[model samples]
Target: MTLYGLKTCDTCRKALKSLDKVEFRDIRSDGIPPDVLKSAYAALGDELVNRRSTTWRGLSHDARAADPLTLLAEHPTLMKRPLITDGTRFFLGWGKDVQADLMR
Candidate 1:
């Protein structure tokens, strides 16, 4: 399993603590591969982007109007926290439903 998120994110920290044997990738430093971002967007659609985040709020109108992939590529923090993937599957955020799914 691999977890993609910011290292300083409290949610990501919580997820790392709760989950076992998962590789953590800090999106800010390590950066997300285009293929991985593409796959995430494919699986999660618009939900992958956290429009409610400060990162989103800080974006210029033109930047906000840009494609989701471009937004994420320019600012990875725009992605919702704790994007957990287990090869074939992808999950966005650490919400209750996602937590339940992870438990399984």
Candidate 2:
């Protein structure tokens, strides 16, 4: 499994600590692959974008208004935490539903 997230994010840290056999990618350093981002956007839709993030809060209205996919590509940290995938299925966030799916 590959986990895409920020290394400094507490939630990401928590998720990383709990998972086994996972490859962690720090989006700040290594950007998400466009195909994976596209697939994640397809699977999670608007939920894939994190509007509550500090990066999101700092974005100008104009930037925020851009297409979500475009915005995400430009600012990878704007994506929600720990987007986990196995090159097929995607799981966003470390929520109960996602944990349930991945832990199984």
Candidate 3:
């Protein structure tokens, strides 16, 4: 299992604490692989971007309108927290459905 998120994010911390035997990758330092970002975009679409985040708020209008992959590649923090993947499936956020899936 692999988890992609900011090391400073509280939600990511919580997920790291809850999920067992998972590898944690901080996107800020390590950066997201293009292939993974592409797959995430395919699966989650615009939902993958955390538009409400300060990073997004700071973005220029043009940047905001850019493609999701471009946004994420430029500003990784724009991505929602704790993008968990089991090398097959992708799950975003720590919401009920995601929690249930992780708990399985």
Candidate 4:
């Protein structure tokens, strides 16, 4: 399994600590793989973009209006935190539902 998120993200840290033998890819440094990003978008849809992030707030209205996939590709930090994939399915965020799915 692989966890794609920022190294500075606390939520990512928590998830990383909780998951054993999982690879942590800091999006800022390693950059998300194209295939993985596409798979994540397919599963999470528009919800993949983090509308609540500081990066989102800074984007112009036109930028926000652009295609979600384009926005995500241009600004990776705009992606929601801790997009965990077990190579088969995707789990976005570290919410209870996601925890229940991944913790096992």
TM-score of each: 0.96, 0.94, 0.97, 0.95
lDDT of 3 at 86: 91
C-alpha RMSD for every candidate: 0.8, 1.0, 0.7, 0.8
Could you give candidate 3's per-residue lDDT for residues 1-104 as a string of tens digits?
99999889999999999999999999999989999999988988889999899998999998789888988999999999899999888999998899998898
lDDT of 4 by residue, 1-104 (tens): 99999999999999999998999988888878888888889888988999998999999998899998888888999999999999999999999999998887
Task: Provide the clashing-pair count of each candidate structure.
Answer: 0, 0, 0, 0
List ranges where model 3 is wrong by over 4 Å. Answer: none
lDDT (10s digit) by residue, model 1, range 25-79: 9999988889999999999999999999999999889889999998899899999
Q: Which of 1 and 3 is ahead in TM-score?
A: 3
Model 1 stretches with alpha carbons more than 4 Å out: none
Predicted structure with the largest TM-score when compared to the true one: 3
Every candidate's lDDT: 0.93, 0.91, 0.92, 0.91
Model 4: lDDT to the true structure: 0.91
TM-score for candidate 2, residues paired by index: 0.94
**Which residue pairs clash in candidate 4?**
none
Query: Which pairs clash in model 3?
Result: none
Which candidate would rank higher by TM-score, 2 or 4? Answer: 4
